[model samples]
Target: MNDHVEKMKLNTKKFASIGIMGLLGLVVIFGSVYTVEEGHIGIVKRFNEAKSQVNPGLHFKVPFVDSVESIEVRTRKNEEKMSSSTKEQMPVTVHVSVNWTVDKSSALDLFRQYGGLTQFEQRILDPRFRSATKDVIPRFEAEQLIQDRATSIQLIENNLIEEMKSFPVVVDNIQIENIILPPKYIQSIETKQTEKNLAAAEEHKLERQRLEALREVNTADAKAQGIVKVAEAEANAIRLKGEAEAAAIAAKAKALKDNPLIVTLTEAQNWNGQLPQTVLGESGMPILDLRNKQN
Candidate 1:
């Protein structure tokens, strides 16, 4: 019975050792494996110190001595609403948006220097963005900022890119979404624009009236010229008719002086053979005078 009890206890110890070894082996296998999701990079650290970096895939490390951290390598956005002043000391609120991404090649260095993504943004990006914005905002006036918003945004972006040159970040783009100015200033601008439009319209009306008056004067001058031309034509016609009538009368008088017998011959040819019924003289006779006279 004693021998059987000792054998049973030995088997129990072996079973317990096997179970514990199996449990430890399972823990080691599970702990050695890690997966880095797509668009992320993994950093392996040993004893709180960064040792190596890995890409997105299944990777293995020392079971209990090493750990991995995954950082996002995708594009990210940070938007900030900041109050700043223009060149003329006008207070304005600007909404700025920055599109950025991590430089994958420098991911390890980034982690080493800044610890993590959050720390990098807080320590480097946010402060630099604010500084760049403040520096650029004061260079433009309120009216300039409103009228030339694209130039202002470009200046800000350039400042920011220069500021982040030494950091491990890629600034894809920067946008100035909105600029809020004073209410009174906006109202004054609108009123000025309205007045300018009214002035332009009035000027257009005056120009139209001037053109209309000029056209009427031209028409009156044309009509006057036409009347003068018609009067001159009528006078010319009357002169020509009088000259023609005078020419015909002179021709008839010349013919009569040139030949006196023409009239007697024409009269004898027209006379019929007849005698007078009564005479005024004592002797009953008819007298004829056929002579041409000139004055």
Candidate 2:
């Protein structure tokens, strides 16, 4: 009995030691670790289930049952070009970028909901981008797409966000890095623009000419009116002066008619002064000497 008890005690002690060793090995295996990488966030999963979200630091999880998933928290970029969207059926190469991140506040929920971030991009971001570009660009002709690409980009962004609404992802912005139109197409557009500008300029010139003609007509009317008024004033002045002169002459004639004695003496003086020369009819011959005859 004593030997059996001692054997039992020894076995129990070895078992306890092994159990402790096993527990320690588990902690080492599942313990938290720090990453040297920047711009990354961590997610913890327990038994294939998301348990917690962690920042960029040392973290631990339940040994074998827990796992850490790292996601890039920083902005990442990729370039894409859609050729069928340019004007003139010309191929347009656009360098586009997608800015994205795992929604940190929803990280645990997201991981659990979507299983991982990788699925989010494949299921949400890429399709959103592709569908948005395809759906919106078709509304525009190739020329409008390339020529008015900024407006097109905005439309694409709005549509992309609308499409991603039911998704677990968020798009910060849809960037259009470059727009390449065929050289011929660009030249054609430029020519059209120049023609439009010329038309506008011609319209302005015509408007100015019309205004100037109107002004000239007004000026001519004004000058004619001025001349007419001046002529009428001069006519009135001359008539008034003539009336005054005629009144003066009538007064003088009346005075002379009333002074008959003075008129007769003057007639006698005039007859004596002029009758002899006409009657003699000398070498200075006169056909009539009417003053002497009247006297």
lDDT of 2 by residue, 175-196 (tens): 7777676788779889999999
Measured on C-alpha atoms, candidate 1 has an lDDT of 0.91
For residues 1-295, write the lDDT of model 1, one tens digit per residue.
9999999999999999999999999999999999999999999999989988899999999988999998899999988899999999999999999999999999999999989999999989999988888888989988889889889789889999998998888999888889999999889889988999999999999999999999999999999999999999999999999999999999978988999988898888987976554446556556533344578
Estimate every model's Cα lDDT from 0 to 1. 0.91, 0.73
What residue pairs clash in candidate 1, if any at all?
Answer: none
Error of 2 at 182 (Å): 3.3
Task: List runs of model 1 lying over 4 Å from the truth.
Answer: 1-13, 197-295
Worst 10 residues of 2 by lDDT: 272-281
The TM-score, computed over Cα atoms with residue i paired to residue i, of candidate 1 is: 0.67
Q: Measure candidate 2: CA RMSD.
A: 9.6
